[model samples]
Target chain A: MQNPAAPAWTADHFFAGARACIPVAISVAAYGVVWGVLAKQAGLSLLEVMLMSGLVFAGSAQFVALDLWTATPSTLPIGPIILATLIVNLRYLLLTATMRPLVRPGTEKRSAAAMWLLSDENWAMTVGEMAKGRGSIAFLVGGGTTVWCFWMVATVFGRLIGSAIDDPTKYGLDFAFTATFLALLLGMWKGKADLLPWLVAALVAIISAKLIPGSWYILTGGIAGSFAGAIAERRRGYAHQS
Target chain B: MLTSPEALLAIAGMLAVTVAIKASGLLLANRLPQTGFIAAWLRHIPGAVLASLVAPAVVTGGTAEILAAAATALVFVVARNLFAAMATGVIMVFLLRMALGG
Candidate 1:
């Protein structure tokens, strides 16, 4: 069912999304800075770095690509890098799919434009808004715009300030993502019914993270937990009928 | 460092794939069912995916990280504010690091 209170596409909705996403944008900015410094160290030019962040726009994938990059084009390991990036980004397939309901009843152009702005941070924020019964494309766009602007600016800034700061991690900026994510997760917690699926997700994620490489844990744990949640939901339905 | 045509080409390729993945669900929206089991399952994805993201990092992190994460969760549960929770975690990590010499 559609949310009756869902706002229409307006400048206000866009700004609301932007305002809501500012906190998460802080973490995104930190990560973007890190990516910029790393990309610089990986021998990317300023133009290239901006282009990558602007075009690719995937943090983990860009990092993975940097890890595989080399000055010699032939030795760049393009195939492996591309593969790893694809794997790391496989979750977007599911993420975008889940967004369909929220973004529906819009034009092909609007839908396509919204899809381009989709990122993990924006998606999480949008979904959280939806869970709160405030689903709106304007919110998504606003949040996505905020994140995009911060990401681009942070990357360029990081590149310019590269090598000046010795360790960003030492400042505990690495925890920014984890902290932001935890907050989002807590925000999304529905009730006791969510405990099992979340626990399953944690268990599977920890295992997959240890056993596998790259970001496979995210996809595996996500899928496994989805199944567990679905099963729990079915059982609850059965109980109600009985 | 300067931009190379080859690198630009590679970046373009990566961009294409990334965009394709991001748009895949929308592109297939018509063909996919939006009800029943699939819908139910999709509903749980955000929580599961987010939990997975945090769990691995916390598990693999040091004592400071664990403690900070705990603090973050506590603040989130109490305040129900994302900014407050994240700020608590970040600040806690810094404090713990300084105090514990990590």
Candidate 2:
């Protein structure tokens, strides 16, 4: 199917979405920048830094892969490391699905074009906007495109200047991504409605990480929380009936 | 080592598999009404999923770190202000890290 005609990008939509995306992009960019710099410091060539940032386009997964690659007594197979990184980034699958209702079905060309631009912040903001039902798609297109451009630029820039700086750790910029994610999570959480699941998942992750290594945090916590949540909701339904 | 042919092939195969699983499941979900237990379970995905990711980082980092991050989450939860909570936690942690000489 041909692309659906939407409203032209107005100044208002441009400003609105651009404003939303700027801070998100900055946090993400900073994280990517630090990753690039650290990856360089850790022995990635400028070529590797650029290639990974552009092609893989995953920040957290790259970090995990980097950590495992750099670990002292390397216990993991290279294939397993790659696959674990694959699982960590699998949330993108759900992200793409969330975007589907916003875009046309079977428009794989357009979807594929947009896939590289998708990330947690962008997807959440876009989905939240789309859920509101009256915002311009122009906001999404403008903001998402702007973010995609900057993420690459920041990574390359950080790699260039980062080596000159003696201690990137001194600035405490490393924790900013963690801060940003916490902020994002709070905003996304609706109410007391989700508090139980949130607590349960966190507890489960803490236990699982202690038990397993090599990024089992991604799998064990996810499975445990999901299963617990399922059970909890079923009991709630039973209570409502009683 | 990252550029080895073996590494590249591994990455490629993994990506292909991840994409296919997502695409197929999503296609089926669209055709389906998302009713029954699966849909109920799916609703837990976003929170449960993210907490699963974030908690390990905070938790294993130490209870002090976890509590500090929770202080951040608490403010956001209470005030419902995203930037304020994020900024305060980061600033507090930075200062604490500085003081502790970590």
Best-matching candidate per DockQ? 1
Off by over 4 Å in 2: A1-24, A41-43, A63-67, A71-86, A101-109, A128-142, A164-181, B6-29, B60-67, B74-90
lDDT for B35 (candidate 2): 44
Per-residue C-alpha lDDT of model 2 across residues A161-241, encoded as one tens digit per residue? 777866644665445445555765677566665777778878877887788766566566666666677677778878888
lDDT tens string, model 2, B18-82? 44544543344345435455555666655675677677777556444565587788888887765
Interface RMSD values, listed in order for every candidate: 4.5, 4.0
**lDDT by residue for model 1 over A1-242, one digit each (tens)?**
23234456789888898999998898788768867876766677889888988888887677657756776665566665666566556667777776666654435456656777888888889899878877577788898889989999999998888667556567776576788778878988889989988999999999999999766687788789888998898888888889
Top-TM-score candidate index: 2
**DockQ of candidates 1 onward, in order?**
0.47, 0.39
How displaced is residue A221 in candidate 1, in Å? 2.3
In order, the Cα lDDT scores of the candidates are 0.78, 0.62
lDDT of 1 by residue, B23-67 (tens): 876667666655567766877876887788789999998899999
